[model samples]
Target chain A: EIVEALIRGAGPSSLEGVRVLLTAGPTREPVDPVRFLGNRSSGRMGYALAESLADLGARVVLVSGPTALSMPRVHERIGVETALEMHAAVMSRVADCDLFVATAAVADYRPERPADGKIKKSAEGLTLRLVRNPDILSEVAALDPAPFTVGFAAETERVADYALGKLRDKRLDMIAANLVGGERGGFERDENALSVFWPEGSRDLPMMSKTRLAAELAALIAERYRERHAAST
Target chain B: EIVEALIRGAGPSSLEGVRVLLTAGPTREPVDPVRFLGNRSSGRMGYALAESLADLGARVVLVSGPTALSMPRVHERIGVETALEMHAAVMSRVADCDLFVATAAVADYRPERPADGKIKKSAEGLTLRLVRNPDILSEVAALDPAPFTVGFAAETERVADYALGKLRDKRLDMIAANLVGGERGGFERDENALSVFWPEGSRDLPMMSKTRLAAELAALIAERYRERHAAST
Candidate 1:
């Protein structure tokens, strides 16, 4: 049994029979019928992750926000535009999965009141009141018999510290953190680096193409997931 | 001279030697390093116009906002992110153009004080103060030796009245109005209809592909431009 577990963690079929529910892309919070408050996520990293996990024989269900990317080959894909819709979609499928990854840059807040029609340019200055959106990752992690929940944090400063804080505060199984707003290796780019953290230890993934990075991250996740399963069983 | 002018308006080389400046896509207003306020323009119509005008032998200089579309074949293409950047690019080149078409859906307002870093999700509610961006079309039309200025109006209600209002108020030579926010034929769609209004007359362009619409609009613009030039000199 020990040898089988070791082989499973190192092989391509490491995640075979594991079910994953993942979210990707940036959610657009509507300010009106035409305008929206959005972020700069291109969804490449998350899409790559989905593909990598599926290559390991995992059944992946992708809950995606508005993006120009074509659908990745997964068990299912649910398209969503806003944070609320994505939240609903994810919650509906969370129960059936052994793992959940929240990689989408979901809006932290949305306009308190979105205009039905296009808002006219009548005001010299406009003040928009924004209400906080639900914390999808925290909620999923807190579920009874929760899956191994992993979250992504894109920060401009203190990348590792913030990622660790989120992992602890949200009671998540793991967190992958990256620095954004720099000249390279973040949002809108095809390459990135990650500082991955869990309760026990952390790993630094050097800068590389998102495809290669996803494969590396998937391997780490499979190993950790198998270890936890072995200990629990 | 009359026969020459008539043939010029009807032929493919109608705009031979004409210098055209056009703007396309939707401007993004930064709320922070990560978040932005944006609209739903696909930049298809403006790109189509650039292609059509270039086919008619015009030297097209396109000032474009960030979009997913590839570069259209034109004499020059200036890519911009914010409304202020777009305004600067257009103003710098306006003096050299014979015609200016504003197809971009520039943001009406931008966050007054954008944060240098990503705003944390600590606050339950937040208020964003927004200030109006420069009216690029009006400023260009107000230039001393302004090009034959044309504007596009996307309205949710009273399309004709608002379009006529814009033409008269802005002192524009022509305005093309289209209805948006419906189930079909606006913003992100490839097909659209236009109600084009000038000082003395109006023309209704029924629903068609943006490519066909651009060709028709270019012909009308060429005819009107020739008439205006003949009357002037």
Candidate 2:
């Protein structure tokens, strides 16, 4: 068991020396002094992916948002709270990466103007004006010499359709889709499953601990990345 | 130092036999299958209040939203994630309590109808139709045999005006207001201060660690509760 654990911890060699960038957790968009917009992302999947990549000897840059999980041992870790901060971090590091995985549950919108202080509650109710946040995956894909981009659609309905749609629309080389909140509820859980979709093919990753699933997914990513690199060359 | 720690942890008997209800952390409003509207509240203030109350021999029912903190050893601990859930929990327990502290940073609005599936990113941006969540503080005040309700206002501007306004509008016995995001900031930090207001007068609680502030506030609440009880008798 000890040897098995050690071998599993070390993982594969396909990604040796490769520079990989990944994102995790939920970005917090400040709404006021004490509060900010966020989600229930635990950052488990992305953390697991980072761990697996690092185990495989990849130079990993894990750009993470606010989560309770401790930092993973990787080449670099950039912690951010807001979606805009995450964008800046990813952009600054993209040029040096060989692959990019957009896994953080990034907020699609943020309060257009977060009150400098806490807004007092009113009987009349409140209306918050919000602006769209940058589509991180799309922006990365639009880069002149972009890294192999993998995006995801964690959905509850029509997972395949949405994943494929995002894959095509964002021009992502691959996408992972999953059903959120059920027997395997996505929020704040330790386990997850995924359906990875690529241009001409797809595969089902069965339900398991997030760590195991991420390790397997990371291996798949390494193989696919190499195939793409060879084909392009 | 050890003796001081022990004394602080056990606290005084000022609130002996009291039953107290507190709400802490931030409520989540689901926007889609994989995402929800939320805020950054560490629940430090509320947790501190719970600890102090528990320390003083009061039975505490901590109805909390999402936070990373571990559960305090009190009479009971009720964990919740959304505004509605927190409301339900508080409403169910209010009849048994002599004091109620609405300290949770409940989200004022929630999606009118959250999508069952993940929302696909749109080019023109997406607008979420939101409706106000039920005012838990106001509802508790309206109870036939209401507890001595204490409301909190963590604000950026017009602190006193807003806190007083909420106290009247919600028919609260007392209100505590604080300036959020300054050197102390109000969320996810260890320290805080408040300007507590009653209908007849007000007092300032100086800056201190959340735990210390809570203990001091708890003492004040015990005194105020006794005064009210004596006058009613």
Give the number of the best model, judged by TM-score: 1
Local distance difference test scores for all models: 0.93, 0.84
Best candidate per DockQ, number? Answer: 1
lDDT, model 2, position A180: 81
Please state the error at residue B136 of candidate 1 in Å.
Answer: 0.4
RMSD of each: 2.6, 4.2
- lDDT by residue for model 1 over A1-233, one digit each (tens)? 99987876666448989999999999999998889999999999999999999988889999999889998989999999999999999989999999999999999999999999899998899999999999999999999999999999999898988999999999999999999999769899989999999999999999999999999998888888888998999
* Candidate 1 residue-wise lDDT, B160-213, digit = tens: 999999999999999999999896597999899999999989999999999999
What residue runs in model 2 are displaced by over 4 Å at the alpha carbon?
Answer: A1-12, A123-126, B1-13
What is residue A65's positional error in candidate 1, in angstroms?
0.8
